[model samples]
Each structure stands twice: as structure tokens, then as C-alpha cells.
Target chain A: MQLTSPDFPRNAAHALHDAALQRALGNLKAGFPGKRAAAVARLPEFEALRDLGRDLKNHIIEHLDYYLEQFEASVQRQGGQVHWARDAEEARAIILGICQRAGAKTVTKGKSMVSEEIGLNEHLAAHGIEPIETDLGEYIIQLRGEHPSHIIAPAIHVNLDQVSDAFHQHHQQYGKHERQTEPRALMNEAREILRDKFLRADVGITGANFCIAETGQTVIVTNEGNGDLTQLLPRVHIAITSIEKVVPTLEDAATFIRLLARSATGQEISVYTTFSAGGRRAEDLDGPEEFHVVLLDNGRSQMVGGEQQDMLRCIRCSACMNHCPVYGAIGGHAYGWVYPGPMGSVLTPQLVGIEHAAHLPNASTFCGRCESVCPVRIPLPRLLRNWRAREFERHLTPQGYRFGLRAWAWLTRRPALYCGLTRLGARLLRWLGGRSRRIRSLPLAGGWSAWRDMPAPQGRTFQALWAERQRAAGMEGKR
Target chain B: MTESTKRAPAAGRRVALLATCLVDLFRPTVAFAAVKLLEDAGCHVEVPVQTCCGQPAFNSGDRADARALAEQLIAAFEGCDYVVGPSGSCIGMLRHYPELFEAGSAWQVRAAALADKSYELLAFLVDVCGVEQVDAHYAGCVTYHDSCSGLRELGVKAQPRKLLASVSGLQLKEMEEAEICCGFGGTFCIKYPEISNRMVSDKCASIVASGADTLLAGDLGCLLNIAGKLKREGSTIRVRHVAEVLAGVADEPAIGDGE
Candidate 1:
């Protein structure tokens, strides 16, 4: 939530050296992409479905105000209320007001990145209301007093031992003090502890994967079903989501859900896909008595008709990060935000200004794996390049880098001068290497020569050799 | 000597070899191998007076300079029947030049025309020239590293492998995650060397696990990066450009190899 994106380089270096984090990141590389591939291979229409998802989101974003108004009327028709917050502070205040009105002592929350973006937990705790994370990953991270390193998998950077230790330390008061080595044991312990909190909580808040304008329904897909209990058992239920989540129809929600689960976790469908519309009906036996939806704009509306419009189509499935090698190496905390990876690289700059988050866009190899795997076909690499262009245009890039690029470009524009200089440089490098034919280190290239040897040039430029060959062939023809 | 019957085309086509800046400065044998392969494929090859492809600037966010270099490149090979390069990364940059210009502008039109005529060497050979195989041989097991640009940008996964199948005794052993980047993203290796080093280190481990005596790749930047790491770690695996191996001209000493 805080703007640590400026420290991305330092964070990446730290993550690279953190052995436990590296081990956790290894599982991400080995696990997600293959499952998604197999899942995609099983469906012949996966690409077509991605197209539909993209088109549907594009249609909604183009006419967002109309859809939001329609969604508001639908929610009001179902005895629910809609609140619009222009930014994070407004959204936080709106949620706090609802909790205060309900006289909530404690609140349970499903996994919501919007809440993290707004620093919601800290705000509630400051107001004397206890906020408990009901999602398993979110709960583990909350106990550790850390932010969600990853979007969907909040505690992905934490290893099994770390989780075991956290649970052992945190769950001792619940009379389950021994450290549980088995994952299922840990899950059962968490379930037991959270069940009590779920019953006592006066308010429940969750994030909606989709807000269906057709039926005033908010959809959430989770494997653990923690979201259902979080919203159902409380007296007051609130859903906090950004405006872009609103879709025109349930069929569009179905189309996106088909891609979201497979792209996120490689499941054809998550175990629990719950759809809730407003509060409990008069005929309903049990449900929340009050329902509210908070829509946060938070600079998203400005992205419409801009270069970053495609980024708004993101389903937050995180397929881009799952396939990204840089993320596979550094983990998500290095991104230093609620979102991470390629999507984060493009979106973080928009939310936090480029001056604070420039490194996010520059930290890619431009391998295009993110774009290749994106279900919505967001041209992620091109968007990153666009960010770079903006960074350059604003003169936000370092002076040294700009000068170096200008010098190189000036030299490259002149073929004869460029060829002559490179020929000399190549010879000099070869001479410096002597017979070893590899430079162990060089000035200004310590970064490259740090972990690898720089191979010496072949002592002659190709142009010179080609010119000699052409001359010899011309002489032979004359003879 | 016969695995299958395929022959080079009769000579007629004029092909310009845009030897990338790396080949022009660091490794000329790659350029020579490319010329040999093209000449053998019944094409009259000419070396254009070309500099860098402006990818470094384009990628570094210096579009003004990148466009200047792109315009220079467009003028250098204007009359050639086809523009081919040994490195897929540079060729991909050529293809992307059109995107750098404003739509419907004259420069954009020129960039688009140049992009249409450009091809990476292996793709040009197998796809355009219809050269089924090369009259070359290498008697060792070698694994190919699919550089990201060649593999993803140009769809060049099968072209080199398809041609390598015809080499007399070359056993193509596939490495795990071969398509992953070797982290020689032009300026990327220098700018983010630690992360780049880790990626290449992972790549080297995969290459070692394949039990191949030699490593090959389509892009010289990746080849150079991988070779540097292998040499630094004191591994015996040889590294060379795929064109050098396919042209039977790789005998000059592999990259980073000498007394």
C-alpha cells in the first residue's frame, strides 16, 4: 500500500538473496504455468473465450458510467445501497462509516486487494475495531504483520516452515500449541480458529471478482469458500471493489470466470463460485440483514481512452506474473505493492506516479511471456515500452542514462564512423585479453563482469573482412 | 551421407545480409557463416553498411534516437530484394520499427516496407528460400537455446531444429526451459546484472543437465551471455551461433575459447 516501488532494485536484490523466498518462488515457476497449459490444452475455445472476455471488458469500460448507474439501480431494487469513492481515503472512510454505524467491534474480511491498496486493516485497528483476515493466505500474512506479497496468493513468499512457525506462535492461545508439519493440520487449525472469529464478527467485507449489472449480484470464486462464510455469518455485509469490476451481464461474468480460474490456479473451475445479490430476502432463512457495495474509482476512470486502457481489462488472474521469469526469480514483494509482476509494472505507475514507480516498468527483460500468456491479450510489453517512452519524454530517466543513449544513437546514425570506432574498440579488447581471449573485468561494465567473463572480440570487424573479400573477387573477375 | 534428399536452389535472388552490430564488432564468423549459408541457398548475398538496429535506444526509452537509427537502417538496404540477418533479435527490431513511427507518415510507410522484406536467417532459409537442409555436419550432441526474440517474436522454434535434423551426425538434445531468456536483453544484462546473472546461471544449469557437449542459439547476445557464464564456471560445453554450425564453418574456435 505504501509507495515502496521506488526501492524496487534494492527489494529485488534482497529477494534474490533471501533463501527462503527463493525456495518459495521456485514452487511458483514449477507449478502454475504447466497446470494452466494443460487446462488450456483441454479447452478448444480458450482463445475465443479470452477474446470474449476482452471484448466484454472493453465494452464495459467504454460505457462504465452507464453500467455503474444500472448496477446501482439493480442493487437498490434488491434493498441494497451503493457508495462511490473517488480515491483510497474516501473508500476507507466509507467503509469505516459503515462499520461505525453498525457499532462493529470486530470485522472479518475476505481477500480484497482494494482493501490492501487503501490500507484498510491499519485504519480499522486504529479505530479500535479488530480486523481479521478470513482467507488462508491473508490470515497467515496478517499474523506476520506483513503485506500480501502476491495478488491472489498473499503469503506465497512464505515457506511451509514459516507458516508453521507463525501458526504455532499465533495459535498457542487456542490450545493447539504444537507446531504442525502437515499442511492439512495447519489448515484445520486455521479453520477452527477462524470459525470462532467468523461467528463473533459484527461486520464482514469482501472483494467482488465481478459485479453483474444485470442482477445486482457480486461474484467471488475461491477454492476455500472463506469468502462465503465471511459475508454470510455477519449482521452487516459490505463488498468493496473498483468500478472496472462491473460487467453488463451474468453471461459476461461466466465468460470471465471461465478464464479467471484456469489462469489463476489452473483449475477448470474453482471449487466455490458464490454469487450474492444484496441482503437476505424475507423468505430466506439465514443471511446478512444489511448489504452494501463500495465502488472505488482511484484514478481508474482517467485511464479510459488513454494508452493504459487495456490494463483496465485485467481480470487480476495474474497469469502474466505466473509466467514471468523475473517474478519467478525475485518473488512478488520486490514489486512493493498490492499487485505485482507484468500487470503491476504497467498499473503501479498509473496508481502511484511514474516518478515513484519507474523501476517497475524498467525491470523487465521484454521476453514477452507475460503478453503471450495474458488471457485478455493486453499488449504488456508494448505498454511497458509506452511507459518507458513517457519516462523519457518527461526527462524522468537518469541524466547519465539519457546521455549514454544519445551518444550511442549519435554514433550509430553514422555508419562509417560507427564501424571505425567499433573496429578499434574490438582490437583494443582483444589486445587487453591477450591470449586468454576473455576479459575478466572492465571499467563501466562491473555489473556484467561481476558474475561472468566478457568474451573478447575476434580482433577484426566483419565489414573490413567483407570489403577485402569483395575486392579480391573483383580483381579475380578482371583477371 | 543420405538421411533425406534436399538441395539448395539455383542462384538468382539478391539477399542483403544485415550483420548485426554484435556480429560486426565481436564475432564476424557468425556473419561469415550466414553469408556462406545464404550463398549456398542460391542467393547472391551482399553485406550492407549497417550499424546498430536502434534496439538499445528503443528499449532504453530513447525513441528520438531510436527513430534516427531506424531511418538510417531503412536507407542502407532500400534496394535489396530481401533483408536477412543472422540474429533474430535485430530482425525483430526491424519488424518493430513501424510501430515507432506515427501512423500514415512517410517514415511509417518506409518502416513497414522494410519490415515486410526482413527475415531472420534460419526462417529465411527454411520458410522463404525453401532450403530443406544444409550440406554440413557436426559429430556431437548439442542443445539449442531458443532466444526469446527468435522463439517468441518470429516463431523460430521449429526452423533451426528442422534444419538441424539434416546435419549428418548432429544429435539435437532438447534442454528444459530452453525457451526461457538467457538474460542478454541487450542493455538488460548490464543494467540489471545480478538478476541477469541469476537467469543465465539457471540457463547454464539446464544446459549442463542435458549432457550435451555443445550449446547453440540463434542470437549472438544470448550466445555470448551463456558462453561467458559457462566459461566463468569452467564448464567444457562449447558455445557457437547456430548459423556457424549449420554452415560447417564453426571450426574457428567456439565463443570464449582460446589459449
Candidate 2:
């Protein structure tokens, strides 16, 4: 929630050196992409489905206000309420008011990135209301007193041993004393602890994967059924989501559901795809007594008509980060914000000011893998380049980098002069390289030579060699 | 006959070699090999007087400089039938030049014309020239590193491997994650050296795990970065440009290796 993006370089360096984090990241690289490729291979219309998903999101976002109003009316018609929040503060206040009105001592929660963005837990705690994370991954991170390093898998950066330790330390008071080593055992332990909280919580909160305008339904796709239980068992249920989560119809929501699980975890479908519409009906056997939807604008309205509009189509699949080399290396904590990876690089600048999160965009190699694999086909590299252009325009880029780029550009515009200077520099480098033909270190280029040798030039420029060859051919022809 | 008249034209193809700044300065053999490959494919090869492709500036968000360099490149190879380069990244930059100009402007038209005709070397060879297999040989187990631009932007993955299949005694051993970037993203390696170092280190480990004696890649930037890391780790695996290997001019010392 706080901006540590200014210290991204240091954060990334720290993550790189963290052996535990590196071990966690290794599993991420090994697990996600291969499964996604296999899942994609199984579906013949996967790419076509992606196109439909993109178009559907685009259509909805273009008429975001209409869709939002439609969704609100549908909720009201279903005996539910829609609350609008202009920003995070407003959203936090609305949720706190709801909790106070319900006389809630403890509120159970499903995994919600929006809540993290709004600092909801801290706000709730400050107001003397306890918020408990119900998702297994979110609960692990909550126990460790840490933020989610991943979008879908919050505790993905925490290895099994760490989770085992956290549960051991925290679950002692819950009458569970044995340390669990296996994943199944750990899950059962978390399930037992969370099941009690689920029954006792007065109000339950969950983040919606999509809010269907056709039926006023909030859809959440989770591997664990905690979201279902969290919203179902409580006296009151609140679905908190951003405005862009609205779709024109249930069919549009279905199209996105097909892609979300496949892109996020490489599943054809998540185990639990829960759709909750309104309060308990007269015919209903069991459900929440009251239902509410909190729509948080939080700087998204401005992004709708800008260069970053395409980002609103993101399904929070984590596919971009899954395939991102930088994110794979440094993990998400280094991003220093709620969202991380390629999507975060472009979106963070808009959500936080570019001045604060400038490094996020510049930290990429522009590898284009993220764009190639994104289900919505967001041109991530192009957007990053746009951010760089903005950063340059605002004079936010370092002065030394700006000067160096300017000098290089000036030299490149003049061919003969550039060639001559390069020739001399190549010769000098060759001489410095001597027999090894590589520079172990160089002035001002220590960043390159710090970890790897700088390959020296081959002593002669191509133009000079070509000219000599042409001269020799001319002489032979004259003879 | 005058010198110009003495030179025989090859089917009037008039191909111009935009030996990217990297090839021109760091490894001219790649350009030489590119010329040979083009000439062998029955196209007249010309070395146009060119500087950088302005990718450094273009990627850094300096459009004015990038456009100036693009204009210079367009002027240099205006009459050429086709423009080819040994590096996929540079040729990709050429293809992207048209986007830098305002639409419908004269310069925009010229940039589009240049972009339309530009091609990376191997793509031009197999795709345009219709060459089935190159008449070259290298006896070794070598893994090919697909540079990001050539592989992603130009669909260069199969082209090089297709060409390499014909080389006598050259067994192609596929490395794990061969398509992953070697972290030589022009300025990216310098800006984020620590992260870049980690990436290249991973790449080197993969290359070693593949048990290949040599490594080849289309772009010299990635080759140099990978070679530098290999050398730092005292790796015995040699690195060279794919163009050099395919042209049979790979007898020269490997990249980052002493003469």
C-alpha cells in the first residue's frame, strides 16, 4: 500500500540475494508456463477465446459508466445495494461503516488485491474490527505478517518450511501442536483453523473476479472454496471490486472465466467457480442475509481514456508476471506495490505517480514474452516505451542517462564522424584487450564488467575493411 | 572498362547490407558472412555507409534522434532493391522506423518503404531467397540461442534451425529455455546489471546443461553477453554468430576469444 517503488533497485538487489526467495522463484518458473502451454495446446480455440475476452472487456470498458449503472440497477432489483467509492480512503470508510452497522467483531475475507490496495485490513484493525484472511495462501501471508508476493498465490514466495514454521508458531493456541511438513497436512491445518473463523465471523468480504451486469452476480474463481464459504456462511456478504470488473452479460463473464484459470494456474477450470447474486431469497435454503457491492474507482476512471486503457482489460491472471524474467528472478516483493510484473510496470506508474514508480517500467529487458502470452494481448512493451517517453518528457530520468542518450543520438546522426570515432574506440579497446581480446573492466561501464567481461571490438571497422577490398578489386580489374 | 562497369550485377537484386553498428564495430566477420550468404543466394550485395540503427535512442524514448538516424539510413539505401542485416534486433528497429514518423508525411512514406524492404539475414535467405540449405559445415554439437527480436518479431526460430539442419556434421542440441533472453537488451544489461547478471548466469547454466561445445545466436548483442558470462565462469563452450557459422567463416576465433 505504501510506495517503496522509489527503492526498487535496492529491493530487487535484496531479493536477488535472498536464497529462500530464489528457491521459491525457481518453483514458479518451473511450474506455471509449462502447464499453461500444455493447457493451451489442449484447446483449439484458446487464441480465439482470448480475442473474444479482449473484445468483451474493451466493449465493457468503453461503456464502463453504462455497465456500472446497469450492474447497480440489477443489484438493487435483486434486493442488494451498490456503493461507490471515488478512492481508497472512501472505499475503506464505506467498508468500516458497514462493519460498524452490522456490529461485526471479526470479518472473514477472501483474497482481494483491491483490499490490499486500499489498506483495508490496517484500517479495519485501527477501528477495532478484526479481518481474517480465509484463502489458504492469503492466510499463510497473514500469519507471517507479510504482503502477498503474487496476485493469485499470495504466499507463493514462501516455501513449505516457512509456512510450516508460521503455522507452528501461530497455531499452537488453536490446540494444534504438531508441526506439519507435507502440503496436504498444511492444508488440513489451515482448513481447521479457518473453519472456526468462518462460522463465527459476523460479516464476510470477497473480491470478485467479475461482476455480471446481466444478473448482478459476483463471480469468484478459486482453487480453494474459502471464497464460497466466506460469502455464504456470514450474516452479511460484501463483494469489493474495481469498476472495470463489470461485464455486459453472463456470457461475457463465462468467456473470461474460460481464460482466467487457464492463464493464472493453467487449469481448465478452477475447483470452485462461485457465483453469488443477492441476499437469501424466500425459496433459498441458506445464504447471506444482506449483500452489498463496493465499486472502487481509485484512479481507474482517468486511466480509461489514456494510453493505459488497455491495462484495464487485465484479468489479474499473473500470466505476464509468470512469464516475466525479471519477476521470475526478483519475485513480486521487489515491485514494492500491490501489483507486480509486466502489468504492474505499466499500471503502477498510473496508480502511483510515475515519479515514484519509474523504475518498474525501466527494469524490463523488453523481452516481449509477457505480451506474447497475455490473454488480452496488451502491448506491454509499447506501453512501457510510452512510459519511458513520459519519463523523459518530465525530466524524471536520471540526468546522466539523459545526457548519455543525447550524446549517443547526436553521434549516430552523423555517419562519417560516428564511424571514425568508433574505429578509434575499437582500436583502443583492442589494444587494451591485448591477447585476451576482452576487457575485464572499463571506466563508467563497471555495471557491465562488474559480473561479466566486456567483449572488445575486433580491432578494425567494417567500413575500413570494405574500402580496402574494393580498392584491391579495382586494381585487379585494371590489370 | 571502369571499375563500376567491371562489377557484375546478380539478377539486378541490388541488396544493401546494413551492417549494424555492433557488427560494424565489434565483429565485422558477421557482415562479411552476411554478404557472402546474400551473394550465394544470387543477390548483389552492397555495404551501405551506415551508422547505428538508432535502437538505443529509439528504445530510450528519444524519438527525434531515432527519426534522424532513420532518415539517414533511408537516404543511404534509397535505391537498393532490399535491405538486410545480420542482427535481428537492428532489422527489427528498421521495421519499426515507420511508426516513429507522422502518418502520410513524405518521411513517413520513406520510412515505410524502408521498413517494408528490410529483413534480418537468415529470414531473407530462407524466406525471400528460397534457399533450402546453406552449403556449409561445422563439426560440433552446438546449441542455438534465439535472440528475442529475431525469434519473436521476425519468426526466426525455425529459419535458423532449418538452415542449420543442412550443415554437414553439425548436430543441433536443443537447450532448455533456448528462446529466453540472454539479458543483452542493449541498454538493459547496463541499467540493471545485477538482474541481467542473474539472467545471463541462468542462461549459461542451461547452455552447460545441454552439453553443447558451442553456442550460436543471430544477434551479436546476446552472443557477446552470453560469451562474456561464459568466459567469466571459465566455460569451455565457444560462442559465435549464426551467420559466421552458416557462412563457413566461423574459423576465426570465437566471440570474446583472443586471436
Candidate 3:
């Protein structure tokens, strides 16, 4: 929840040293993309469903005020409360106020990236209220006192062995009475510990994947069923979600659901997709006494009229992250923000401003896998470039880069000088390569040549070749 | 080469080949390769007086400057059959340029035209030209890295494979996470060296695992990064532009021609 604009140097150092994190991240590169492809192959209507999903999200965002009003009104009518928080501080304060009024000593939470975004737990704990994370991944990260490296897998940076270590240290406190190293054992131990917390917790906080205006329901999709328990067992339930999570109807939500699970976890549907409207209705077997829906704007309103409005349609399925090579390498931590991967590359800069998050946009190979896999079809690479454009406009970029670009631009404008420089540069590189035919190190290029050899360029430019070929073919060349 | 299958339009397509700064300078052979590929695919490949694709400007966040250059490119590439490019990144820019400009502006109209005909080589090969195979062959164990723009924006995933599949004796072994970025995002490698190093290293490791003698990609930037890493590690693998492989001109210059 506390957004640390991670300095790239420090984050990269940590990512490099963090072996457990690497192992966990390695699993996602193969596992998630493979599953997603298989899932997409299964659904004949997948592309149509994606278009519907995009349209529904776009429509909801276009008329967010109406949908929010409709959703809030329905919640109020169903004996629930709705709070609109202008920013993270207000959202956190509202949740804290709810906890204080509930006389809540302990609060159990489902996996909520928005709550992480708002820094809800740290605020609650500072006020002397205990917050227990019920989701297994979130619980692991919570135990380790680290941020959720990934949106879907909060503890994606932790491997099975590290989870075992976390359990060994925390299990005694939970009275589980044993240390477990196997994934299944660790999961069972954590599940047993969280089940007790679920029952004893006075309040529940969860994130909504989608909030249906038609049903006036906040929907949560989870594989572990922790979200359902976190909401149902507690006397009071609070949903913290961004404003863009709203959709017009249940039918719209269903279309998104068709794409969401496939994109997120490669499942047809998450093991549990629960929708709760307000609090308990009369004759309900088990339900919360009170429900609160807190919609937080937190900079999204600024993006609505701009070129970046398309980003608001993200369902946080994280297919982009799973498929991203950069995310695969450094894991999510190096992005230095809660959202990592292609979405994070674009969104982090927008949320935190380009100066703080500038390195993120430049961190892509522009492989477009993220866009290809994105259910809502956010053009992430272009959006990232837009952020870069903003950075240049503000003069926030480093001075060396400015000088480099200026010189390059100046050279490019003059064909004679441009060709001369390239020919000379190529000759210099080829010379530098010598008998090895590869330059292992050079002053400015040492960074590149550090792990990769610089290939000697062939002396002539393509323009020269085309001109020669045109003359050979007896065509009057443009030049 | 096939006959031009003109789609219904009067906006009159005249495509300028954005022969990428890399292809133009280091690998002019690729530029010519792209020309042959595009012309064979049916569009008149024009070499406009263009330089960098404004990616350097765009990525540097000089939107106004990038827009200026983009405007110039739009003007230069105007009245083309289609603004085709050999590089994925440049083609991506052409295709997505309208998103950068105000809709209904003169620049937007030109940008739209530039994008409409602009195709990364393979996308132009299969999607535009609709060529199933070229009369070319290179017998080698090769693996393809899906450059981000070609894979995503242009949907060139199957086009390269479809063409490569026809090459007699060319074994195409699929690399793991072939679509994952090589992290050679132009300025990215220079700006964030540590993260970029990590990414490119992973990419190299995967390519090495494929036991590929040659790693092929549409984008020179990615190949340069991966090849640099592989070469630095002293791996005995060669990196060739997809065009070079497709043109069947990748082998070390036929026995003693230079000698």
C-alpha cells in the first residue's frame, strides 16, 4: 500500500540477489503463457468475448458517474453503505474509521491489490488493529514483511522453500505446531491457521475484480476461496476497488469473466467467483451484518480525457506480466511499484509521474506479447512511449539522453553528415573488432558489450545499396 | 512475385520503406531483402527520404518533436501504396500513429495512411502480399524470436513460420517463451542496463536451450542485444535478420569470393 518509487539500481540489486524470487518467477513464464494459450484455443468465441469485454469496460468507463451512482444506490437500498474516496489517504481513513467503529481488534483480508495500493494494513496496524491476510500468497508475503511483488500472486517472489521457512517461523505463532517444507504441507498449515482467523475476525476487507451496477454487487474471483470466507465470516465486510472496476450489467460482467480467468490463471473460471450485494439478507445462512463499498479514484480521473484512457479498462488479469520477458527476468520487484509488467510499465509512470517511474517505460523489448495477451487490448508499448513523450516534454529525462538525442537528431537531418558518421562509426567498430570480429568492450558501449559482443557493421548504408541496385536494374533512382 | 491484389480504396497507397536505422546502416542487405520481399508480396516499396522512425523521439518523450518528425515522415511517405517497413518497431509506429495525434487533424489523416499500408516485413509478406512461400532455402537449425511489435500489433507470429516451413531442410525448433521480449527496447538497454542485462541474458539462455545454430528475428535491435549477449558469453551461435534467412543469403559468402 505504501508505494515506494523503487530506485532502479537498488531494485535491480535486490532482484539479482533474490534467488527464491527468481525460481518463483521462472514458473510463471512457462506456466501462465502455456495455460493462457491453451485456454484461448478452447474458446471458439474467445476473440469475440475479448471485444465484448473491451466494449463493456469502455462503456462503463464512459459513463462511470451513472454506473457508480446506480451501484451505490443499489448498495444503499440493500442495507449497505457506499463511500467514495477521492484518493488513497481518504480510502485508508474510511476503512480505518469503519474498523474503529466496529470495535474491531482483528481484521481478516482477502487478496486486494487496491488495498495494497492504498496501504490499508500498515495504517490499521499503526492504529493497533491486527489485520490477517487470508489468501495464501498474501499471507506469505505478509509474514515476510514484503510488498506483493505481483498483483495476482502476491508472493510470486517467494519459492516453495522460502514459504517453508516462513511457515517454520510463523506457524508456532499460529499454533499449527509443525514446520513444513512441501508446498502442499505449507498450504495446509496456512489454510488451517487462516480458517481460525476467518472465524474470529471482526471485519473483512476484500478487493473487487468487477462491481456490477445492474446487480449492485461486488464480484470477487479467486482460486483459494479466501475472498468468500473473508467476506462471509466477518460481521462487517468492506470492498476497496478502483473506480474503473464497474461494469453496466451482470451480462457484461459475465463476458469479462469469460476472458478474465483465462487471461489471469488459464482457468475457465476461477474456482470461486462470488458476488455479494450489500450485507446479509433475511434468511441468509451465513453473511456479514454490514457491507461497505469504497470506490477510490486515486489519479484515474486525470487519465479519462487523455490518450491514456484506454488503460482504465484493465481487469488486472496479469496475462501481460506472465508473458513479459522483463517481468520474467527481474520478477515484479524491479519495476519498483505494486503493478509490474507491461501494465505496470505504463500505469506506474501515470500514477507516480514519469520522473519517478521513467525507467519502467523504457524497460520493454516492445515484444507486444503483453498487448497480444491483454483481454481489454490496452496498447501497452505505445502507452509507455506516450509516458516517455511526456517525460521529454517536461525535460525530466537525464541530461546525457537529451544531448544524445539532440546530436542524433541533428545528424539525421543532414543526410551527408548522417551517412559520414555512420560509415565512420561502422569502420571504427569493425577496426575495434580486429581479428576477433567482435568488440567485447568499448567506452560508451561497454554496458552493452559487457555481456554481449558488439557486431561490426558492414560499411555501406542501405540507401547506398538500394541506389546501386536501382541503377543496375536500369530504373531511374529517386536519388 | 504475385500480381497486386488492390483492395477497394481511392486514397491511393504509396508505401515508403522505413528501412530502419539499423537495416539502413549495418545491414543494407536486409533493406534490399525487405524491398525484394515487399515487391514480391506486391506493394511498390519506396525508399522515402526518411531517417529514424521517430521511435527515438517518441521513446525519449519528445512528443512534440516526434510529432514534428512524424509529420515530415507522413509527408514524405504520402501517396504511397502502403508505408511498409522492415523493422517491427517502425511499422508499429506507423500503424499506431493516429493514437498519438489528435483525430481529424491533417497529421492524423496522413498518419492513418502511413499506418494503413505500413507492414513489418513478414506481416506484409503473409497478410498483405498473401505469399505462402518464397523460392528460397537455408538448411540450418533455426529459432525465431517474436519481436514485440510484429507479434502484437502486426500479428506476424504465423507469417514467418508459414514461410520458414516451406524452406527445404530448414528445421524450426520453437524456443521457450518465443514471444517474450528480448529487452532490447532501443534506449531501454542503455538506460536500465542491469534490468536489460537480466532480460537479454534470459533470452539468450532460452535460445541456447533450443540448440539453435541461428537465431532469427525481424527486429535488428533485439537480435543485436541477444547476439551481443551470446557473443559476449562466447556462444557459437549466429544471429541473422529474418530477411537474410528468408532471402537465402545468410551463409558466409560462398567460399573465397573475398579472398
Clashing pairs in 1: none
Models sorted by DockQ, best on top: 2, 1, 3
Scored by lDDT, model 3 comes in at: 0.80
Q: How good is the docking of model 2, by CAPRI class?
A: medium
TM-score, structure 2 vs. true: 0.98
Error (Å) of candidate 1 at residue B255 is 0.7
Clashing pairs in 2: none
TM-score (all chains, Cα) for each model: 0.98, 0.98, 0.91
Per prediction, the TM-score for chain B is 0.95, 0.96, 0.89
- Candidate 2's error at B245, in angstroms? 0.8
Chain A TM-score values for every predicted structure, listed in order? 0.98, 0.98, 0.95
Poorest stretch of ten by lDDT in candidate 3 chain B: B1-10
Residue A24 C-alpha lDDT in model 2 = 92
Per-residue lDDT of model 1, residues A1-479, tens digit only? 57788888888899999999988988989999999999999999999988888888899999999999999999999999999999999999999999999999999999999898888999999999999999999999999999988888989899889999999999999899699989999999999999999999999999999999989999988888899999999999999999999999988899999999899899999999999898999999888999999999999999999988999999899899999989998989899887899999999899888888988888899999998888889999989988999999999888887888888888888888988999899999989877878899989888989999888999999999989887877676576
Task: Write model 1 residue lDDT over B48-95, tens digit each, in one string.
Answer: 898999998898888988998899889888678899999889999999
All candidates' lDDT scores?
0.91, 0.91, 0.80
lDDT of 2 by residue, A1-479 (tens): 67799999899999999999999999999999999999999999999998988888888889999999999999999999999999999999999999999999999999999999899999999999999999999999999999999998888899999999999999999988999999999999899889999999999999999999989999999988999999999999999999999998888888998998888889999999999999999999999999999999989999888988998999999999999999999999999999999999998898878999989889998888998889988889989988998888888988999999998888888878998998898899889988988899989888899999878888899988988888888897788
- Residue B252 of model 2 has an lDDT of 80
Computed on C-alphas against the true complex, the DockQ of each candidate is 0.56, 0.72, 0.46
* Model 3 docking tier (incorrect/acceptable/medium/high): acceptable
Off by over 4 Å in 2: B1-7
Candidate 3, residue B4: Cα displacement in angstroms equals 22
In Å, residue A156's CA in model 1 sits off its true spot by: 1.1
